[model samples]
Target: MWPQEVLALSRRWLLVTLRERLNLLFSVLQPAVWLVFFAGAMGGAVDSRVVGTGDYIAFAVPGVIAFTVVGNGVTAAMPLLFDKETGYLDKLLSMPIRRSSLIVSRFVFQTVMNAAQVLVILLVALALGVRPASGAAGMLVILVATGLLTLALTAAAMALACAVPSHGTFFAITGFASLPLLFMSNAFVPLSAMPGWMEAVARVNPLTHAIEAMRLLVLHGWSGGVPASLGVLVLAASLLLVLGSWQFARQTAERIA
Candidate 1:
């Protein structure tokens, strides 16, 4: 029953997203532009020696993939905010469906959307000469890592959506939080290049682990760090899912009451 409900909800959300053609284009375009323009300009100016790769684009591709997940994942709450504004959320909560399915379905949809965006970024990267050393296997690992990261971010977004009363407040909060998380991580630069204190923070950032793991997979094939990276992502995803589920339950209960 739960599986069916989740799937149905996810399908509905997916269709809504697909119907937004401009949004879909822009979602893909944002990362593609970064890959082509930003990466292109920086890839040429930066010495490969500093980045620890002969091709700076290759080094940056994984980071861009990580960035894509983070960028898209953070917006997972917008749908809920829209629903709430339109009174759709209250209507849905009034239904007999499993309340937890609301959270799960959003997570599932965002995970798939993030994966699609990552694929588009990777394809653009490949066209620009970025090649993963691990080949097909490495691609699979990248997908898994990105999916887990997306799931974690989506869960957090859903929790914030439930807790916040307005879309403006939610976007402000998420934007404030996401930028620091992205810049501090190994998304655009290596940890070694950062200041001592910043490097310390990056060491513990979940995004760092995800980026590092992806770097190892794409640039050098599977390494010892792969298991630890994936493990952290999986654990974070599980914990955030629970948190979001709890928030959804609470919010729904209040509405129903």
Candidate 2:
């Protein structure tokens, strides 16, 4: 029953996203632009000695992949906000479906969308001569890391959506949060390149771990920290999912009250 409900809801959301052609185009395009322009422009300026590789494209690919997760995950809650405004969320809650289905379905849909975007980014990077050192296995690890990170972020977004009073506030908060997180992490630059304070902060950033795991896979194949990085992501995702589910139920209860 749970699986059926989740699948039905996920399918609906997926179709809605697909039908928005411009959204799909920009979703891929934003990251592609970063990969091409930002990476290209800055690649030359970066000292190859810092990253231990001459190819700045390769160094930056993991960061771009992480950026894709951040970009997609932060916006995952917009649909929920729209539904809330339209009262569709209330109507759905009135149905006999499991309450948890709402959150699960969103997570599933966002995970798929984020994965697709990441795949497109990787393919484009490959076309431009970037190859993962671990080959297919490395790519699989990247996808797994991406999935876990997206799940955590998507769940966080859903919780924010339920907590916030309006779509405008949600957008403002997410936008505020995303950029700092991106720049502070090792996504675009090595920790060695950052000042002491920023490096310390980046060390604690979850995105840093995820990006490092991916960098290790892409640049050096499997390594020691891969398991730890992935484990942290899985744990984070589980906790966030539970929190998001709780918030979702609370929101529904408030609607009924």
Candidate 3:
């Protein structure tokens, strides 16, 4: 019953998102724009010693994909926050369905949506001459790492949405966090290129770990770093999922009480 409810709710959210065609278009286009323009503009100026590749686009493909994942995952709270504003969340709390299903379904929906968007980004990268060095197997590993990161981020976002009182507050917090998180990571530049302080921060940034894992798979194929990077992401996903689930359960229990 719980599984069935989660599936149905996830399907409903997927359909709702698909119907918002412009939203979907902009979501894809935002990252695509960064991939093409940002990578193009910065590619020539960057030293090969810093990026470890003459082709910045190839190097940036993973970074831009990570950007897309983080953007989508962190902003995954908007819909639920909007529902709160609309009184829909209160209504949901009163439903016959398991309360846990509401949170799980959102996670499912965002994961699916993020994966689709990432696929389109990969296709665009391919058309632009960015080939994965690790082949199909490497691509699979990239997506797996990406999905783990998504789970961790979406869990955190959803927990924030529930805790915050308004969507505007949520927007402000997420918007403020996104750029710092991106710039601090090896998203556009490698850690070797960063200053000592920034490099220390990037080393601890989950986005950096996730990007490095995917970047390794995309550019270098199999490597020792891939497993370590994936390990970091797995730990992040597991910890955040547990914490987020607790937040959801507590919130729902209070609402019902």
Candidate 4:
């Protein structure tokens, strides 16, 4: 990959994200809002032991972070679709830069943006009387897991962007997929609390592994499950990165041809 081109494009997109102040504010706030309200509503009703945390807020914090990654990472391709519509993508295609740089830059931009959002959510969680049981070291593990999950989601979204004919269709597909994935995971509750079938689904869900990893860190410190969860994320991210890169390269070639 062309590192310079990737960095340049990543920086350009980051600036655009910053310029859209309202969108940026909402992106950060939405997760925080969900963490606060969702936790408050469920805290008293749900048993803390069932949720696998001291309180619902603590349990929901990682869930909120994971969902934020889903929300932002899945829409990471919107700008690419806009570029395609405006002929900017064609211009980039005509340039000497590596085609993979486009995908890399998108990954970089989404990862950074999600990181910032996660930071806000963590601060909000802290204010709500949550603390990471494993301290700063566990917090770092949470970030790493979150980053891998972001990479996988963003890569898959960009691959879909290349596959779909329009941005509207992309939105439709991702919108349909995100919420179901959230509900199927052990994000808000422990797997033991889920129905048999949903529990089975959650067992295999990549998002579940990521959230569980974060939950383990936040509520229980390091555990044996952390490696397995991180492994799942790493595998998913690697495979999706390859798929996305290939899809983008093929699309570029076809457009050029």
Candidate 5:
């Protein structure tokens, strides 16, 4: 079926990804820097009374991981866009593979890669004294929640890469997006301290849910913001991805002509 074709395409993408050493390194370093310098700079000041991590650092591990996966996922479709502009995608379409299969495969591969990157970040968090709040069960739940969120966001990002006109615009959008959202989310501080409006915004941010979910798994165990925030993340990512996919299909179809 198409799913099998998608998986096969993902395998091929992995091989191609291995050739892009700079992208791989930069992607790994970017998130690590955020967790180390940006996070450690705060010292012991980050709070998690509401978000779940005992302190800011622990609370941040998930957010940092989410940031990594998100950065990678949204940019995953960039190469395809470049290929299209350069005539590579046209040649690809001429191959034996089904047209939609190529797109689906790329999305699947990026989702898996994003998940892998987050795992590495999680390992680093363990080394940094950020142990899970609950036992194995909590860790599993957190993993599932994070994976779903990451996968959905990655799809949306890839969709943007497909629909956006140029690599310049894609990178610009990513830069503009990463910082403001991170700051606005509950990654660094509890929403409690913010003005009522900002607090409300943070409460609704998908990133906030991702952070809250991680906080529960790592710091507070089962009693954290598991239910509420996780729900928001899923719902929001789903909506965005649907919109992105629609846009991507429209653009790709135009290009195919």
Candidate 6:
């Protein structure tokens, strides 16, 4: 019975997101523009040493994909915050069901939305000559990793939404937090190229593992040591979900009381 409520909540969120046709375009296009226009405009002159990969397109493609996922994942929290401020979330809590369902549904829908953007990015990458040697196996690994990483980020977003006072504050904080994670990561540049300190930071970034896992899928053939890459992402996401779920339930319960 509890499981059914969770499923229904998740389903309703999915439908609500689909109804917003413009969000569908804005999410995908924002990332695609960065992948195509920004990457193209600055392709030649900016050869940073961290970018060991000779082909500019190869260097940029994976990073673009990572950005798309993170961007979409974090922003998913906005709807919840928006609803609460609008009194919709309080109305939702009046129903006798597990609060976690309300949260899970948003995360589930977010992953779906991000997946749509990824498909477009991948097709554009193919058009630009970034081929995946892992073929079908590689793509499967990429999708699996992506799903995991996105969920993990979604948990962080949920936590942020719960704690923040306003949506603007949430947006500013999440954007500030996300941009650094992307920049300091091995996304655009090789770790070897960074100064010792920056390289060390990127080394520790969980996103680095996710990127390595993804690179193996698209660049290297599906390698044997996939677990290490996946473990970092899945572990981080699991911890965030646990922490966020606890906070969400506690906060919502107090509000209702």
lDDT of each: 0.84, 0.88, 0.86, 0.86, 0.73, 0.79
Q: Model 4 off-target regions past 4 Å? A: none
Q: Candidate 6's residue-wise lDDT over 1-257, tens digit each?
A: 77788779878776776798787668667777788886777678567554655466656767787887777777788888888789889988999887878987777777777777777777787888888878866776777777887887888888888888889999899878999998888787777778899989987787787887887667666676577889888888888889888878877988899
lDDT of 4 by residue, 136-183 (tens): 888878889889999988888888988899888998999899998998
Better of 3 and 5 by lDDT: 3
Which prediction has the highest lDDT against the true structure?
2
Pull out the clashing pairs in model 2.
Answer: none
> After best superposition, candidate 5 residue 117: deviation in angstroms?
2.1
- Give the candidate order by descending TM-score: 4, 3, 2, 1, 6, 5
Q: Mind giving the per-residue lDDT tens digits that candidate 1 earns over 1-257?
A: 99999999999987887899898889877887887887788977887767888787778887787777777776778888889878999999888888888878887888777777778878887887778888987888898988888888888888888899898998899889988988998888898899999999998788888888898887888788889888887887889888988888898788888
Give per-residue lDDT, candidate 6, residue 134.
82
Q: Each candidate's root-mean-square deviation in Å?
A: 1.5, 1.4, 1.3, 1.3, 2.8, 2.1
lDDT of 5 by residue, 89-166 (tens): 778777776777877777677767766666667667777877777866876777777676765766677777776778
Q: How much is 143 displaced in model 4, in angstroms?
A: 1.0
Which pairs of residues collide in candidate 6? Answer: 50-190
Report the lDDT of model 3 for residue 233. 86
- The window of 10 residues in a row where model 4 has the poorest summed lDDT is 47-56
RMSD of 5: 2.8
Candidate 5 global TM-score: 0.85
lDDT of 6: 0.79
Clashing pairs in 1: none
As a whole number from 0 to 100, the lDDT of residue 255 in candidate 3 is 68
